[model samples]
Target: MSDTTTPEQLADDAVVVDVREQDEWDAGHAPGAIHIPLGELPARLDELPEADERDPLPIICRSGNRSGKAVAWLTQQGFDAANVEGGMKQWAFAGKPVVTDSGADPQVI
Candidate 1:
């Protein structure tokens, strides 16, 4: 089965990868999340931590759809990845930290 994680349950050391497009990512994203648009994932594999590192890799998008696909692909490649259920929407609703490129108020786009 595909691995999945909730925003509230994300681990402290987990590596968060935001797979939204540039416009969406610029609006708001988890602080420190790696910005790798889903379309660029295949070419950006090197940006992800190695599977042996054992740190959880939580993939997120505007909602959960894209991240779920990413989780499936990454898992197939042997990385310990999981879909961030409900994605940024749930994260913001749960009061999780978010940041914007211009220091403006964060919003899910």
Candidate 2:
């Protein structure tokens, strides 16, 4: 099984990849997280930051399900990746900062 990490366990400087759809991502996401919908991930793999076993890439979505699948695919492609358990919902619940493209307040969709 792939590794699963909770939002609270994330490092402040960790580079996070958000794999939700565009609409979901525009709704809200972790500050500074990269936006790459799951469907586009294969085509956009090069856009992701470099990662390794010691520093696995963090992938998240509205819920853990999508991110988990992403982690599986990424790992197969030789990327060290982990799924964010409970995803954006848990991240927001953990008091992590969420942001939007607009200046409006952010909330997980």
Candidate 3:
């Protein structure tokens, strides 16, 4: 059996970093994910909690490209960061829950 976690395994306790631009974030993103936009990450490293330094931190973007770079950077910075496999697009395609400003706010179970 594969030990890989599904989107269902994601929780508030897991650190999910969104590295897209502010415009992208304002649109929609993984619920509970921390927005650190790639441009500011280098200078904003301190804002990330110490727990993320040791625990798994999943970096995400609209697609996986930017987050891949983020994963590399964070790993180099001594943080345990990983790319969110296929990013939000995959999450959405997989029928995972997402938050959007489409009038009614649906809850993710």
Each model's lDDT: 0.85, 0.88, 0.70
C-alpha lDDT of residue 61 in model 3: 83
Cα deviation of 78, candidate 2, in Å: 0.9
The order by descending TM-score is: 2, 1, 3
Candidate 1 RMSD to the real structure: 1.9
Top candidate on TM-score is: 2
Model 3, poorest ten-residue lDDT window?
Answer: 1-10
Candidate 1 lDDT tens digits, 1-109: 8878898887433469999999899888888589999999989999986543544588999889999988888888878888889999998888888888899988898
TM-score of 1: 0.90
* TM-scores for all predictions: 0.90, 0.94, 0.75
Tell me the deviation in Å of residue 49 in model 2. 0.3
Candidate 3 per-residue C-alpha lDDT over 9-100 given as tens digits, one digit per residue, 9 for 90 to 100:
56633557889887677666676778899989999998875544434777878767888888888878877776776777776677766675
How well does candidate 2 match the true structure in TM-score terms? 0.94
- Tell me, by lDDT, which candidate is best: 2
Per-residue lDDT of 7 in model 3: 50
